[model samples]
Target: MKNEVQVKGKFHYRLIGWKYSIWVRLLLFLLLALIFYMSLYVKLVPQVYDIQLGAVSEKTIYAPRQIENAVATEQAKEDAAKRVQPVYRVVNLKNDALIDAIYDKLLQINVDEEVKFDDKVSIYRRVIPQLISELENQSVKTLRNSGQYNDSLLEQIQQGLAEQQYQLPEEAFFKLPRLTKEDLTAMLPVTKDIVSKLMNDQILDAQTARAKVAELVNTSNLTKNTSRELVTEIVRAVITPNKFFDQKGTDDARGQARESVKPVYINKNDVLVNVGDVITEEIYARLDNLELLKDKANHLPQLGLAILAALLSFVVFMFVRQSTLPITYNNSQLVMLILIFLINVAGMKIISLGQNMDYPYIGYLAPMALGSILITILLDAPLAFISSVLFSLMASIIFNTEHMLLFDFRYGLVSLVICFVAVFTIQRASQRATILKAGLMISFFSMLTITAMMLMEDQFSQKEAIMSLSFAAAGGLLTVVFVIGLLPFFEVAFGILSPLKLVELSNPNHPLLRKLLTETPGTYHHSVMVGNLSEAAAESIGADGLLCRVGSYYHDIGKTKRPSYFIENQTNIENPHDRIDPNLSKSIIVAHPRDGVEMLKDFKMPKPIRDIAEQHHGTTLLHFFYHKAVKQAEEEGADNGIREEDFRYPGPKAQSKEAAIVGIADSVEAAVRSLRNPTLEQIDSMVHKIIKSRLDDGQFNECDLTLKELDTIAKTLNETLLGIFHSRIEYPSELASKKTGT
Candidate 1:
């Protein structure tokens, strides 16, 4: 798979560059967009029913002037009861009884109705015939009884029958016997000239003629007929009730006016609203029947909202495209991105739910986080911040008002901030507990944000404040949980060695470490000293000090296999180095690193530690044996037969910061241990000599160790050695007695 990627891909498996893929950018855009969208959708989609949050403020909802009317209604009922005062006291008909009557009326009225406009004439044809016969009778009666047929008398009967008239769409009016205003105005040119521009082809210049009529068409020149017509059109356009408004829908049952019996503070004479009159869908649709453009404009706000979301998505995608982030997203990220897009589109589509729940504002946090966590863990904090900003803008559309927007912005800002806090604060070496701490921090910030929003909204009514505060707490705590839950999966999937994982592996009881302690106590003790020496040296070089210490602890486990053969374990010992050939002894020493790798493998130690134990010695020739062998071989006349290669350990060299530090510490500790009554000069010399020899042998070639860093390492080793093996004034006799078991 890697070979295929390398052969065909542009920047093949760059441990650093996979995060900047266009796919990642696109996913980020979609994820943020979806979060914005879901903020809208969750409100609408969940119950498929509006959770009516009646007007919290005076501005948003229309109020009825029913207080005085209700009082009058009650007074009228009281007057009737007073008329019956001889028998009973006045009764309250405007309370429970009014509610009951309304409920009964509601049962009788089924608005699940399909209004038929086209079949109107056909359905009412029979009534029309009867109405015509009645009108004929009335006309005959006017002519016969009154001794003359007057248009006025005949009009009275038509007026009486008008209440039974069947109304239909104005388009159908063309098929009726109605007189057109043009017919009357055309016959009356004087009136037409005064109120309208009459096109008379006989006039030469149409423009001049229109200008001439325009002057006469001023308000002063309006004839009674034209004035009446003007008033009619104005009334139809403005004063006529919008059919969509159902006045009943505006009835505030809990308003002060409805308290007890009368709506408080409102003057009865000032009342204009009546029962069964309101702004409803019927009123709007009827007005929509007259104004084509106004109806079309109604949907524009929602459409504008959608466009805003898309624009935000574009901006976010562009930002993500330009970023240099650090996470490598998996297929799941793409899946999450797709999910967000779907949710955003769905949310926006059902934005009517905003009346019940602020989906765009309240709903955005979850999906945004779904993307944000991936971004923080895989990429970087800045990208998550960009994503949050983008998501917030997109959310504005979901919430058409600032109140909804506040909540939406808070969710995004907090989510992004929390993601940064979680990712940047906790390293890979951290563990599950860190996630909880992060959650607490997130919670703190969340509560602060909620408090701020509440104070700003000042609906700081206990209920509202508490509700908002709870949501903030939930969001913060949940973010921590989300991060914690996701860490382990990413660590295993990506083979990431976060700081947390390293810390856990550093435990002394780990199987490999335990084996080294039990099997090679002498080597173990040596390793501990080397660990102390190397950790300080590594820290001075700004290397991973923990890795240095841990590596040194397991560097020489192989020597345990033949403890007697090694000098360190020979207590009260024989002079094996004196008795054995120098070549044999050198071979035994060189073989241990190789043997250590085998032991570590058998113990199932991780590969990195095994490499350190095997490669710490590198390919450096043992100078002591080389000189001795050269002397012996030259004497035997076989000088070329004994190659320097056989004397060296078969090594691949220090391949990391820790390995190199271990090697340096190993040589320094041995040299320092060899000192008898050594002065500070000798310790400094030993540290520098060992480092210079390793540098000359090219042991550090594979490792990234600089000269400046090496110098710091030498100084650190010298100081630490002096401290550990420092000479001191003899203790007093009482402490000395304890030391001697006296």
Candidate 2:
């Protein structure tokens, strides 16, 4: 009874596996059309970052040519020298205004001098007179410039100047509004009042003049020099030659050799060289040469860029075709490509806009790694390979101007090796460890490729090659680190079924399958064999083998609810079908798939595994029960008759790759297992025949599996099934009985 129920499970799975819905194919076709349309509109052309002649760029170098021809007047020069000096204005306690300015104003310099409130006001009062004089001149000039003779404008200007007395001390740094004539005139009347106010307040005592003034005036003019030593610094700025290296006072090393100084003569055949310096005269000559680029001065390689773009685009087209991964409808795939290209553009701009950016080794951090990792993970090997080649070309354009091909090949080769290494290493395992291992492999390969590219150039020294190799190593490490970090984001965002998750479900210890194993061991044993068969078949088709195995494990979990109804869960039981009505028997059996899907959902299985649990049987008729119902009606002379469709399992068919693959493997496994004393020839015939039946029944309607892949899957299943259920030469019934009875 257990064997019969297991056989039934297999039959249902196989029935769904061989279908290919026309709708799925049509959807894929539409997706390709959209992708093709986008890819075509994107023109693949190389850009030469041509620098225009005499374009306004921020020039930092001090040119000797810009020096003034007219010599400065001695008096004016001397005056500027005195004025521009960094003179720290120490607050003289004798001047009240100066002391007030020091305490109230945000000083230009830090000072530690103590100033009495009386002296602060006096000091600022000294500076105010000149400020007011300059303020009135500016206001009158503005009125004259207005070209209006109105007295109101003149009076208003005078009134505005009247308000300037207190604010006169504020400089341009204070952002005070410009003064008018009225402000100045008004201040004139109050100027004496301000002085009187400070005198009454005892804020004026003395005035400490500037050093220039102190030097010019006699000491007798001052009442007393009681000012503290405030370290009033004055900077006499002179554009003198950098005289720090001028050692005229020191004895010359060439002193004695001056009279008998002989120029060092070099013999053409024997030249003495210094240590740590290259002695190549030819190389030294090259250092002094600088190319003066002129716009439209030389022919631009416009056509050359076009040709390169064509070749690259062709390679890209080939790679996209070979992968057989339909990503045109996938928004994630489109977004990834867009992001990668934008990074490439930004990197190119960085390299081109550079004035003294030391590149050829300082690969832009983003494009070098993020692009490669994304291509390898999102796209497959072929697409990654093509992108790597294109990126190599872009790298050369990004890093090189005169020698564009050199850097392009160097980066391109490194990227290809890293991407290739990435795809292969990660194709089997979705674990973090695999990503790290892939990184290590990428590092080695990238280093090797960089080394080869460097040597081929015949230009770089050993040290330079080592630097390039360092860049390659960094790129490899970055690829691994970034992709590994980004994996969880992709998984949750896209509901991705990575290989690692599939592996976890494929484990024999999974709880739902374990319950089946202990409670209904027959079902468990059958599932295990089915898992093995499906895995091999799925692998042959390049559909996830782990997914096939894992899906098969939970496919029959509904059998647990009605253990006795299922043949595999029954133990030495009388046939329940004999006593029960045929309709009841059919209901109990057919409910397993729907019940299993619900149980799988409750256990929180991934959608693909859940899909297999439900979609394994598709909508195929339960022929035995349907025929039994017809027979019962005929025997009992019942007027009512039943449709065969009523006995079918309600289904959407195998709607995805893994679901379809599992369905085929499930059916083939049960059919082959149910045969008692089955020969190798019978197993071979049964598996093929089961697949053919499914294909004819249109069970595999909603998946992307092609006929070629299906054939491959079938062949793989046959091989694995043969190995597991391999026949042995029967010694005899007597030998078999003797061994068993002992």
Candidate 3:
């Protein structure tokens, strides 16, 4: 039976080894890349059409994926630029300085009393022309080096100043000489005030400014008509156009307006043209820019997508290779990971199809947490975290509807939040129902994330917000359904022993456990004690405590075959080992490990449980039967030929930390159980002795049990055993109590 079990176990190992080969791993990665490529192919490389400009449309065309409508975008930019009004800059003409110079010239003429009134008038007129000519020439020279001087600019300046050169008429020249010094002094301030006020305002045309000067002067403090007339003429001569066309400022403003106009998009499934409509230049250009034209098909997007797929596959491959998780070493687990990725991506793709209905929030219903939750429960949480980020990235791309954008960050952010929430909430899941709780957590966080994204938009739509929240909540519930439905398939197909499965196996009502309990109650009780010891010890070293406990429940199942022969189930019956030969008794004792393995295999127990049952004994000698045979041989004075190897159980040794710890716990429990009220010292000594014996025998060499971990296990076992077997106090007898009462 042992040989037969070994051969079957070897066949199983060979099958697993074949799947774990290097070529198989490479092929699995290739398949993963292929799945990514196929899922995104249509979105990346849209269909092209065979239509021409000005031709009658044969069929209605819609955008296959989100793309920027370059023609429409440019037109929008042009419209925005056109809407920007022309910029005008106010030019400082220094009109106050010109008015002050005119007043000073009049003062100088008034001070020259040596001339006749007619000669003074003639002199005033000549000096006014000279001062105006000199000032205008100086103004032109000042603007020449200012970089604003051009032939048209200079011509505009001359035209604007044409009103300023009011030739003092013969009548006005005579009026200016008649004015007294007091009149001239009062007129100076009025003239300056009117010119300054008019220049301070934006004077686009000098003629418009001159028309307002007379009214302003009349309203001033100048009461004399001649003084008012002189001030009006002087103020009018100085007022030129202060506002000019700013060509550079206007161009910059238009450029800014153009830049401020966002690009127009042809969203996925948006109609580009309708049937029976002529293919105008605008529509033809839009199709051509989108690369929808037959001869203008662009393959670069597809190539870029393929490269991205390959890169993602390579990153996953490298991560698995470098990961310390036990499942990462298993090719079957790698295939399962890829399958989970595919399922999540497919879910995103399915939801993305709703984009055609013009529902942009449909991506919120993608069940983004499904893959991370499954991974956290079935595999490792750290692996699930890394995979969650990747899934979010894929979701962003798959659900994108924005023109010319590779990813929609709104979807990515929501997906990332939900995926992380699912992983954290379900990492320690011990039951299938825990997935539902995780889904609720994912849903709550997803709604918050989606709401945050919506609030960031320029405009908020209550209907869209409500739809997104509904989809997010539904997605969480949907994830729970998917996880519950798919978990069993993955567990069964891959022969995985998740925490939920371990919890189920630990139940005492299991068939093998029930058989052990009914047929060999003492051994069943011993196994339970061993499970307690093993679980505490395994947990001390961060091993799988539940696995150790479940394995211990069925470890002694083979004892049910001969309950009477095992001393634990002997009860009041005669000692079967004393009546039988020592050699036969040794054979009976050593056969249990092999028999237990066979029974477990028949029951389809997981490989970890089977390994524990098969390797827990680990070739340790049955000292009682071996010592008894040696004594019998010495007394008979004949060679019994009792080889020490023949008394030991055949084993591959404990192959894992949990198995090693279980073996030590099994030995420690049996040794302590035989003691009559063992003390803490005795229990501590027994636990250390068992562990030390195994360590010295090289039984721990096959596993990764370190000396420090073993010491920790021994301390934990000693503490647990002390709790179980602590001393109890005795109470007084009834006769003594009655004598004391009398």
Top candidate on lDDT is 3
Candidate 2 C-alpha lDDT tens digits along 131-216: 44354545456555665424444443444334322333223212211222333233322332333333333111112212232342
lDDT measured at residue 603 in model 2 versus the true structure, 0 to 100 = 76
- Per residue, candidate 3 scores C-alpha lDDT tens digits across 211-290 of 98878887888788888887888877777776766666778899999998877767776788899889999888878877
- Report the lDDT tens digits of candidate 1 across residue range 1-742: 3322321222223332434455655656666655554455322221111111221221222211112235566665555444431211111111122223322322222221352333433433433334334443544354446644234433443343343222333433223222234433332333433323332222222233334443443443345554344322211211111012112222332232334443233321232223334535533333233221131224444555456557766765565446542222333443444443454334333432322222223432232343444444444557655654544444343433343342445554554455455445543324557656666665666567657766787655676556556655665565566556665666565544445555666678887667767766667788899999988988887676877777788788888777767656777878577777878988888988988889877866656678789888888788778888788778878845778888898887887767888998998888777766566778888889989999988888877788888999998988898788877312256456878999
Best model per TM-score? 3
Output the TM-score of candidate 2.
0.52
Clash count (model 2, backbone only):
39
Weakest 10 consecutive residues, lDDT, candidate 1?
237-246
- In order, what is each prediction's RMSD in angstroms? 32.0, 22.4, 26.9
User: Model 2 Cα displacement at 84 (Å)?
Assistant: 38
Any residue pairs clashing in model 3, and if so which?
none
Can you give the TM-score per candidate against the true fold?
0.50, 0.52, 0.65
